[model samples]
Target: MSTKLELPIQEFTTPYPVTAREDSSIEELLDIVKNLKVRHIPIMSNGKITGIVSDRDLRIVSALSAREKFLVRADDLMTSDPVTFQGNTSIEDVILEMSEKKIGSVLVADEKGDLQGIFTVTDALDVLIEILRGRK
Candidate 1:
């Protein structure tokens, strides 16, 4: 019997990788988040993932004044060098990393180091339940 994780990270990931430019306004990114129902948006600059903005990061802007909010950009508040995982990575490995890091999610990138998808704790838990029930 193979003990390898049957479920791949990509299987449970959110793809098309919504992203924001480093120079983009917080309002723009906020709008993206609202309209797309995305919790995290990767900050892309020069075709690279420079940072990442999470729902929590956006809330910090909401806590500020309307005028002050304009002063903020995705780059200003996003987490730099966030934990990232590969598309082929196993769910078990990702779950372990997320648990150890106490993070809710991690960016999923492809073989060429391009942003591919996102894997969240919620996604992992859902997979866990399915696997336990022999439904995967």
Candidate 2:
């Protein structure tokens, strides 16, 4: 077999994934995240990925709410204009972007302007380990 390792991200990434509307309520966003069992949820505006909110962000918001005791909307809580990755971007490039941004995940989008899956640090690390182990 060839030594070159093939990346599974291309197949693992869920193209046209579920997205949260900018106007979506925090409760709705929470429901989606819980149901989908995903850490990062892309916030879409005008059919474009505008921002992202991770489980960490949500927990922070929730903790703050518990202290101050107030509810917040998704738009009010999310990190706006989060870094995004194109589908064609190499796995290496994605890793670099996440590192430079100091973020855990990056939203994936396509040329037609649709929400694709998310690439988390976990995903990148999986790829890295696979490559190091010489697994195709």
Pairs in clash, predicted candidate 1: none
lDDT of each: 0.85, 0.72
Q: How many residue pairs clash in each candidate?
A: 0, 0
Q: What stretches of model 1 exceed 4 Å from their correct place?
A: 1-6
Candidate 1 lDDT tens digits, 26-105: 88988998998988888888887788888888887788987888788777998998888888888888888899989888
Q: Which stretches of candidate 2 lie over 4 Å from their true place?
A: 1-12, 64-71
In terms of lDDT, model 2 sits at 0.72
Model 1 worst lDDT window (10 residues): 1-10
Top TM-score prediction, candidate number = 1
Compared with the true structure, what per-residue lDDT tens digits does model 2 show for residues 58-135? 777665654342356667778898776567776766777689879988777667756767777887777877778977
Model 1 TM-score (2 dp):
0.89
